[model samples]
Target: SQKIEQNSEALNIQEGKTATLTCNYTNYSPAYLQWYRQDPGRGPVFLLLIRENEKEKRKERLKVTFDTTLKQSLFHITASQPADSATYLCALATFIQAGTALIFGKGTTLSVSS
Candidate 1:
């Protein structure tokens, strides 16, 4: 069995600052880790995905780092704005494990205030 953990608590950051979120897993070595953003009253929106083999991946102001040895992944949002505020989730693709077993974290809410 695999266990994925996130802050479960909300993160507070000011606008224009860099918001860093963490995801830690144990009892499993997933080939890849994925990040998503969920706004109130809506489904999660995919943000980024990093493979165990990848050191870091970036797109625009979003960046993700996967450390297989540490069994952790870091998600960053640069120049974060108030609009960026949302609950971020880390998930593992169950399909990669066996057939299809999507595992998700409890999610960390980010509050970016201007």
Candidate 2:
């Protein structure tokens, strides 16, 4: 079976700073990984996805890196603002006989302060 883990503690950062989050997995190979942001009451919103063949991907102020060797993915938010505060989730997809299986981490909550 595969397992995913993220920071158990909440991440605190200041506005205008860069925030880095980590996602680690074990015992499985994923074809791609995705990041999502979930507010208190809203569903998760897709942020980024990086394929196994890709080393890094970026969009606007967000960046994601996939390292198959390390079985890890790093998520970064540059020029973070208080509005960016939310629970960030890490998910991985693997193709199976039935379909694609998506596994999600517990997520790391981020709080940006002025």
Candidate 3:
């Protein structure tokens, strides 16, 4: 069986520092991986997507690295601030009825203290 796990607790960090989070999984090789950010009571917004053939992907203050051998993904936010506080989700692509759906882990809440 395939499984994905993200940090179930919140991560608190001071403003202007880099925030790092982890996503671990087992038993499957996905076609791609995606990261999303969700604010309170809202749907997650897509951030980055990395294919299995890729090593890393980045956007603005965010960077993501995927390691298929270890079946893990690392997400980072540099120069973080209070406005950056949100829950980050990691999802892997799974095929369903000729379309793709993301298999998401429970998400890690990040609180950036100013």
In the order shown, the candidates' Cα RMSDs to the true structure are 1.9, 1.5, 1.7
User: Going through the candidates in order, what is the number of backbone clashes in each?
Assistant: 1, 0, 0
Residue clash pairs of candidate 3: none
Looking at model 1, residue 12 earns an lDDT score of: 96
TM-score of every prediction relative to native: 0.93, 0.93, 0.91
**C-alpha-based local distance difference test score of model 3:** 0.90
After superposing candidate 2, which stretches have Cα over 4 Å from the reference? 94-97
Model 3 C-alpha lDDT per residue in residues 19-112, reported as the tens digit of each score = 9999988867787899999999999999999988999998999999999998999999999999999999999976678787768989999999
Per-residue lDDT for 1-114 in model 1, tens only?
688899656999999999999999986678888999999999999998888888999999999999988888999999999999999999986545457577899999999999
Taking the tens digit of each residue's C-alpha lDDT, what string does model 2 give over 1-114? 678999665999999999999999996669889999999999999999899999999999999999999999999999999999999999987556798788799999999999
Residue 108 deviation, candidate 3, in Å? 0.1
Task: Indicate the worst ten consecutive residues by lDDT in candidate 3.
Answer: 93-102
The ten-residue window of minimal lDDT in model 2 covers 92-101
List candidate 1 stretches off by more than 4 Å.
94-98
Q: List runs of model 3 lying over 4 Å from the truth.
A: 95-100
Ranking by lDDT: 2, 3, 1
TM-score preference between candidates 1 and 3, better one: 1
